[model samples]
Target: MRPAAAGTTRLLCLAGVVTAVGLLPWLSGRNPALTVLRARSAEQEPTREALDAVRRDLGLGAGPLHLLGDWAGGLLRGDLGTSWVSHTEVGPSVAAGLQVSLGLMGAALAVALLPAAALVAPVLVRGRGSAGAGAAMLAAVPEFLLATVALLVCGVWLGWLPTSGWQGPEHLVLPAVALGVPAGGLLGRLVADALPAVLDERWVELWRGAGVSRARVAWAALRRVVPPLVPQFGMAAVGLTGGAVAVETVFAVPGIGRTALGAAKSQDLPLLQGSVLALLLLGLVAGVAAAFTRRALLGPALRDASLTLPTARPVRTHPAIPLTLFTLLAVTIGWGLLRDPYAVHTTARLAAPSWAHPLGTDGLGRDVLARLGHGAASTVGTATAVCLLSLLVALALGFLPGVAAGAADIANALPPVIVGILVAAAAGPGTGGAALAVALISWPPLAAHAAALVQEVRSSGFLTAQRALGAPRSWILTRHVLPSVAAPVARHALLRLPGIALALASLGFLGLGAQPPAPEWGLLLDESRAYVERAPWAALAPAVALALLAGLAVSGAAYAQGRAAYDQGRRTVASAVRKEAPVGI
Candidate 1:
């Protein structure tokens, strides 16, 4: 297919994805308002009919496919439906939120893109030490921490920007920058990495040797350099859009992100769904437009009708630490089989670390070591469950023609918090609930990655030969595509671990994950807040553990990614058109 045609096809497929994902939250049978009505009107005869009406209106009573069709058809006809909690039309509120968010996205993206592009020229010219290091360091800073620091200094200390709700465009400056700076730093690092490779391309060397001016050579390289960044930026756009929720909550911006968060907190289905759909549309439209722009810039000479770019060089590093972490986790899980986590030590209440309790004791006198061990078991167990479930489901989705990636993209576009909140609402708070929440949010990228690999391998000469020889679909997948998918899947899974860990931790911290008697890292953090000054070990142990674990996961992921990249480069270029899945929040 032609480049433009393929871009359009992909865009159309993503529209289908939007439809699939937009219906996902409503597929849950929970309706808080209806539950309230039932409890309130238990003595009334009309309650049953009212409950049925509420369920039907929310599409909870129908099959998911039927619900999707009904909702999507209504959306096509401009019927946005009324809020289940407020009874207000969702359309106007969504429109206003959309405008504010788009503006914020524009400003944040500009804040990110401009600095990145500006820094790119110098980084390319000066070599990758100073600017590259700075960008990488900035990229390493977490979004939430960045936002918190920005709010503290800019809002509280300096009193320059308001640390509260949306008042005017002026109110956006600090929050936008807080969000944009890290995003910009991320983009800058990508550009920095690409510039070195682009400059080293044989064509660039030939141009330089042919007496082309440095300025002209740089200009040509920059143009080609930007084409690859478009897709990366597209993926980044979704994460940033999702990430805006954290910033929105921190800064109290009344954008769609805030709306989504509020809806999630209250289990407000209509508002949540509408706000999520708007974010999905934003990402879908932005990604398509970016992809098309990349297509145009690539031109015929560069693109060969498939819109594929030169894949980056193999990235590799050692996996020792991460592997060791896994080994230790196995030990922890095994220990859980023998240890009793709930045995209380009342005499040791708020006790410091001792021979008996090496990790100290909580105010409740629970053995922190045992609790931490149990927490590790639970957290790792939940993470493992999420990973396996996500992969199984994603692989199945990957089998569907074009739809898997589209749906995955749509799923990826929605914020993780929104998805997690809804999934948790449906399942209720517990280990299983958190696993389902994380699994639902995590699968999209895996699905997208798997789909890309499947599509790439489907074009191989041998694969075609097998099909010509009448091999079964299942046989071909099991024998051929399945093996090829392993490296990429492993790479993506490892890379995603840190984020998943943090997300799980965040859930626990918020009291939405494992309840009391659970030593989950986030819950430990929450529980230790009051003891920070006196019994610092209460918080420090878990915090330090989380950081070390995150570091190991990142290292392991880096090594896996590098190995995948190296192996991919050794394959045929036509078979090398696989995409790097974006790390989900």
Candidate 2:
């Protein structure tokens, strides 16, 4: 297809996806007014007539198709529908939210780039070791935790910045820093990846040999890096749409994220649907535009990743450790689901660990074991769901021909915290929200990985054989490409477990995970913080769970990297063995 035609088709597809996304409230039985009125009806044993009246009054009778038609019809007339909360035209609110969100994203990106550039510069000289590792670690920290710590240390302790609300420049500082720190860390790695190639250029060597200052060399290297970096950042910028929810909410930024969040909470269907659709389109367009802009600036060089940089070494981690962690996670989840956390044990109130009360009790005289058990189910379950869901989405994208790279770029750039928050806002606080959020944000990296694997496999000798033999593309792909890529994708998923775990925890910690009484570890931490002095185990129990989850995640990532190195060496030796084998055995 022609480029413009293809672009138009893709836009149409994305519009359809957006419309489908807007219909989720119906798909999941999450209609806000329906949920609320249902609860009231249950309390009063409401009549069928009264229930129907309530549904009609709250505008809950419309199906997803009808809602979409209404939304599109309103758009044709330049109306953004109306807000249920204030009964005002949503265009004004959406516009205001857009301004805030855009400003926040811009500031956050600006703050992130400076630090990332600094971090990347050192790696160009040092090679990939300390600088790269440190940056990667920092990037792994969830934005919600980053924001919380910043608030505690900077706002409460130091009185440096406002903890909440978009009042002025000062208000934006903390949120930007919270969001930017991880982004900068991510960008730094990309810069590190891109830098070595620039430094390897003949011109760079000649400049250095001619005694051109290190500053000049660095500047030249940076200029080369920027083109590749711009496209990557474009993807990241779009990913920020879902991920910005926590940043906006934590800081009360009054941005589109926060507005949409409220709309989701209240089940203000028209407002929520319109606002989310607009923001999503905006992010997607900006990212695609920025990436293409680089193509315009640097031509084919910026477009072809292989020409710009080498394949990234696959990250490795301890395969056995993740299994162990997964087992423990499973146990906790199973136990939690079977037990009641809120059942008070009057005699064992605030009791220390014993045969009956293994983990100990809390300040409220509740059984600590029950609560911990409950939390384990939610926390681990949420993490597992996030991990698997992300992989599935990635797999789907990778199955597509050319879309994987762009999709992956955007996904990688997104913060899981932002995604978790957005999902929580739309789906409400539960497994569905956290899992969907993590899954959405996690797709980019996996998609990118899958795309690369597909590209590599497409050129393999076996595939060439199949093609030459006139085997169908589907048969070749099913029998060849899928098998070759499966192991690596599985390993990548293991490598990503820690990130998924952290995101789940971060969301729960911010009261955006499983709601009250659901034993979510992050929620436990939040709930037990007040009782830390009285019953340390209540807090310590959840803290330890989180730490273990994090450790397991880290181990998996590190192990994946080590395994990649090991496998590469083994392949080299095997290749040598085959080369030296007698003809036809």
Candidate 3:
């Protein structure tokens, strides 16, 4: 057999084995009733005998092989058995939750994408630096923070929208906007960056020189750019799935997130596992769709590009800004460490800021300031790690075939709560466990982005030219393609960091994150719920910290995108000028 075929077979076997191993515990945790029902009548003697007979009759009594066969058959038929926690049919409950989640997600995408497209159009047309900066600022804000602010302003203060519950369209607006804003900002930057390249293409210039109107050129450029965005749009849709948990919880929506959160807290293994599996399946479907769409849009060119290396862009050294930003970030970190956030000691009814208890105490007698500080650190750290890990996994998987890449995307598209549940079940709940869970959930989008970047870079003239040269494939890929794609990929990765962090913190807040005594921000919020009326600051402090951390991480990503655009702009102008030179004698 060919080496490639052998590799493919090996990978398939590995995937099957890993999946089976991962699901073993969940299967073992199913209801005893279902296990007994599938057994032989002859073994039914006394109650204990009947139980043993049932186990034997079904594959469970026979051996590992029988159990595996039964499990595989059940999985193939989508008979996930009953949810151990909810005591309902796993499939139906998941289906119901999925409907609500998808509805909210669809609305969010509409709100986010349309406005982003409109906002980015002018930037793409003018190639303005300010436009990029604006996009960055918008993208930098975290969704949960945005949701909280929206709740206060639109729901509480103005009463323009409902603060909680999925009553109707009005309730969705606040949460959807909160979710869409960050996504819109990121998408705006992407569209803006992509447009300039298409606008400055040789064909565009050639058409322009032939007396085509600026409008025509712009329209044509947009047409070309639109097709490449299908995969991106699908990827965005998938990523949004992970955010649904926070959005649903914040809005008090009756969705899968709330269900999963409740299940996790109760240690309802079957319900949690079923929810996770459903989420994974949803993400996989989206990813597969995206992969097919990418292929359809790019045609045979993408396959050719995949096999080739990318080329390097000229790197311009920018001085001092990175250092200055780093310094500012450090100061913020220091401030978080030193400052007291919570006010009013509900536990003691003591006055604020005495020498004995500088930051006072919470209703539970916990050190408010210390908890807040630690919570901030933990929240930021966990989120950042999850986002980074997810990105790395996604990038690794993205280089595979379209089908495999799509599978990664599908995994990314699964709901964050579901992912959280799976991770918690698979690894158990803790810092390490949460991070791993986040990574597993976040991998699909990162993979999609990496794949898209690879496609974009592969088609560039520099890469093609490099290939035509006598350069070895490995040397060219390392020296050229990797460098060219690194900055943009890094920017994409950074942009995702805040969102993941917010989601993790939200999960924690809902009591699905770090177990007690971990000092996580989410746990702090949950702890503060009883005393919210007496000491709102107890909850408010951690909430605000979560928002700010998300904002800063997002800002960093936006800044990176802006710098990348500026650099790309300069290269395009230089290339245009070179092409316009007169012929030598």
Candidate 1 TM-score over all chains jointly: 0.71
- Kindly list the per-residue Cα lDDT of model 1 for residues 367-441, writing each as its tens digit: 766776778767876787677777777777665635565555555655565555556555555666666667766
Better of 2 and 3 by lDDT: 2
The lowest-lDDT stretch of 10 consecutive residues in candidate 1 is 127-136
lDDT of each: 0.68, 0.69, 0.62
Task: Summarize candidate 3's per-residue lDDT along 370-417 as a digit string, tens digits.
Answer: 666666677777777776676666556545546445354234455565
Could you estimate the TM-score for every candidate?
0.71, 0.77, 0.69
Once fitted onto the true fold, the runs of candidate 3 whose alpha carbons sit more than 4 angstroms away are 1-71, 124-131, 209-215, 295-368, 378-417, 439-506, 525-536, 557-585
**TM-score ranking from best to worst?**
2, 1, 3
